[model samples]
Target chain A: MKIDKQKFPDTDGFFGEYGGKFVPETLMYALEELEDTYSKLKDSEDFKKEFYADLSDFVGRPSPLYYADRLTKHYKSGKIWLKREDLNHTGAHKINNTVGQILLAKYMGKKRIIAETGAGQHGVATATVAARLGLECHIYMGAEDVKRQSLNVYRIKLLGAHVHAVDSGTATLKDALNEALRDWVTNVDDTYYIIGSVTGPHPYPMIVRDFNSVVGFELIDQSKALFGRMPDAIIACVGGGSNAMGAFYPFIDKKETRLIGVEAGGNGVSTGEHAAPLNDGSPGVLHGARSYLMQDEVGQVKDTKSVSAGLDYPGVGPEHSWLKDIGRAEYVAINDQEALDAFHTVTKLEGIMPALETAHAFAYLDHLPKDFDESTNIIVNVSGRGDKDINTVAEIDGIKF
Target chain B: MNRLRKKLDHLISIKEKALVAYLVAGDPDLDSTLDLMHLFVKSGVDIIEVGVPFTDPIAEGPIIQKAHDRALKNNISLPNIIKLVEDFRKVDDSTPIILMGYLNTFSFHKELIDKSDQHGVDAVLVVDIPGELSISSYGISNPNIDSISLISPTTSQERIEKIAKNGSGFIYYVTLRGVTGSSNLDVEEINSNIKKIRSYSDIPTLAGFGIKSNEDARLLSEYSDGIIVGSSIVDMITKQSESRNFDRIGEYLRGLKNAIL
Candidate 1:
């Protein structure tokens, strides 16, 4: 129950048999340099001050922990509290990590930054930071995503970042990730790979999680101030699980609090179209670390379909896999239709338009037991706003946006 | 040591650089892959690297990526590639065959190492495994199969030493700063790095990536013990698929060999 977050990754950056450096030989040094610099700077007061200053001034930190009274009325059992990361600058919690990494990049003397994104929130956030820092930025996005999320492509370009439409391997997040890695490998000297999630190899999962843990840290303080006690459970949608890791990490040592991760079930888990790796997949090494993945018998990563581009990945963060195996956290799935319904429900009830990805976590409320303790408060991470997803949602709903 | 070591040692004794050739096992077709393997040997390839096709190969450039797509279209899997090596071994067993691929393919086929060794696979070169990581850690290693580790331009000297220590068959010195098939090689930098690698371990170092012409191969062979050509051969196969002038592959490989010698 007592988890020492510092001792984790045990020098090699592993979380139990999960996270390890599974990158090319060319990237080992860059990761090592990052690991060294991050380790030294993370605990420094100066770094914390800068990060907090940015959070307060730029990202609008201390995102409110608002009570979803109507949603709780519909659920009938538990009181639901929403961690409004969707309220942050760039309309998502992704800015938290990008800001931290771009600062680290500047410190490391990296003049160029590269990133890969699925839903475009991370891409937009990364572009925003790179633009603010005046660093050369390149975002690799799948060609299919480029077509579906043209607005985000335009947004990234407008931020002065070049968007490379990747056409390899299903033309989705995984393919874009491969292309980004290729770009990183080719330009390791002057380029900083700003991985948008807590997934990549070693320090990335640790670093991204730490950078975003500001969300949970803020939640802890605000929850005590507003609710008189910590919430009984914390919930977040897990794509590569950056937001979930951010929210759950601060509570890792809080033994009494429950952590639930919701995954995109797509059509349904049985139909094999889901991105619910933790719920229905097996342990395998993917991207750069050992994690739960939607891979076939031969270890070939399977194609995943989800209504939300952010949750359409075949792999989950390595720490989530470790947490799942150790029985420290619970994971469940929400289907696309259920998420859409929740999207509509949250928008109508709370007047808060939830990103389709965040809707998965909101959708989990409908599945909670009716006899569950009414006194226990549940905090769901509304990780992003739905502005970027408006077109996709509109087209699906037969509304021409 | 295995056949790869033996082949390298033989080449060294004869004062010739080992000309290593790489080809995806099921590119174009399985039958063509079979023919290509023999052609590589007859055309003076000291070692033949057979790529097992997978849906995603991150380290590859556009040429090999397309080759993998073509190979996968014909339903090529790890077992079938190992079988292709088995078939290659039937007629000629002297030329070393290194099964090159990603870690997932090797890990998926549970008995890949045993199968590769039993079928006379001389070594294995997994693109993702850096020197610090071990193939044995994933339960993939065999005495019969020398696990080749890669050293890149960005690889620190400390890691180069570490990789050279663990590396078996040979240390593959990626001559370029990027993925496979990428252009731009600083031969002087590669020569110096190879020296650093050789300082740590006596494992024969081979230069690869962007060795397009016979001149490039000959130029690189002077600094390292051997050379490995991937994109050039894969590109030839792709262009010659319509020509079906598969002999051109042999001719090009022979040209690389003659230049190195």
Candidate 2:
């Protein structure tokens, strides 16, 4: 019974099973003129005082929710908690869905933005929010990811932007998302595009999972002020599942935490090798909707061997396909020589080097659930920064040059 | 007052004669791709396209690139072909999906082609960027999202008015130089290059590569405005995977989409 974006309003977000205006009727009057200028700039108190003074003086939210206390004394009873989002501002969590889609592309006046990357971390976070809101950027990677992320393609060309490279197909990141959807269907009137993940279509997976639900609404206000408690388990690493549904949709009505996710099981999931798409995928209907993929028997979309070019993608995330068909998220699998043996065991035990898509949540820390030994805490969501995978992890551990 | 008169304003109040089908999404898997897109939109198929499956389609041939390498040996990406056109727009939200792949799988995903205009997808052809170049050779905007473009038979007439003022859905015209499923159906030079792209724009100009029967979609839908077939329905699913008699090739593509509508 999905149809409920305020009862099929039909601005762009449909709601049948549930909805999908599926975008591009030449930006259907620029997304119905930015949903009528975000419903009259939500009672414009000067656009919420310049959107919370640029969300607390330009992109620095309430970040840290730390306490890994050395990976939680070997899960003695489980109290891990890390949610750093690799300390935001372009290092990861793709700049909280690129500062709310570049302030809805500067309230739809749209003076050019267009994105698409693979490991140039969301085209250097949409070229650092189109260079602090002045706008005019470009991106689109995959001439083999601008020659394997040449320093995030020179940090999206030192934040001025205009990158290109593409060379089409297997050049990578799904051909820089088909050349930023053929440059937003050939410049859908000015340009803004942005989509880096949480897969695509439908109000961009609910606006990049509501701008990465400010990382699970500040991990439920810092886990109810440090252990008055909630997360008995949450974990992350889903790729295209927008930092695992922005750290699992504000604790999805907290049903005793324990959620998980992981995926990417490349070289495992029985030698079909892995990008574990919702635990060895099946559901079908790729790219637009209907989830769980890693295809074959004829429904195409297969090449996913995940050395984690952002979890390589075959498919996953229609709300993680409605949280794995309503079990409230559990899906697993973590292969590719166990995410390169948890990326060389979390860079020689915690110096960090994480992002091989957070090495599939540290290769499923010995298959979760051990129950209340040290007061069960767990959170995970680390999200990025293995410094663009140090030359494919020093040439897959053989280490040279 | 133009863009194909507002894309046939919900098809000129059902005037008729506009069938168009074309396939290729995960080939034979995504649950026979949601039962061959619900028997190609209940066999009326007023526009479906889909395809996607690429590896190196380069103007395709060899049985639609072996049904696109059996749907990319089952990894069919372009966001799993726009999540199968946003799950067939939750059971057909007024037909019209379109997508046709390559151009580096929709340029990787340009925010899933501006979120495939909310997934009911009205158009996007690609097959090696052919015309107006979608906003000067790839910049994409989305005035409801249509980009079609494929002018061959060795395109000219001064590159069909610069690929018909940079194409925007309603001009594919290839008629055979070779590839897609070439057996060759040049039909008097495809009705003389669709009467020379209907002398530049009034838009609607279809015609795909090596079409194949119901007299090649009634001899290229009586000189264009329809006919895109695709390696004869991927050579009837490679003769239903070499005759295990797969549901009699969905009753031979419901007898070629009811003998080309």
Global lDDT scores for all candidate models: 0.89, 0.69
RMSD for each model, in Å, please?
A: 1.2, 20.2
Q: Please give, as one word, the docking class of candidate 2.
A: incorrect
Model 1's TM-score against the true structure: 0.98
By lDDT, the best candidate is 1
lDDT (Cα, 0-100) at A122 in candidate 2: 86
lDDT of 2 by residue, B25-91 (tens): 7776665766777776665556767788766454555566567767776767777677777787787
TM-score of each: 0.98, 0.35
TM-scores (chain A) of the candidates: 0.98, 0.33
Q: Compose the digit string of candidate 1's lDDT tens values, residues A109-201.
A: 999999999999899999999999899999999999898888889999999999999998889998999999999889999999999999989
Looking at candidate 2, what is the lDDT of residue A54? 64
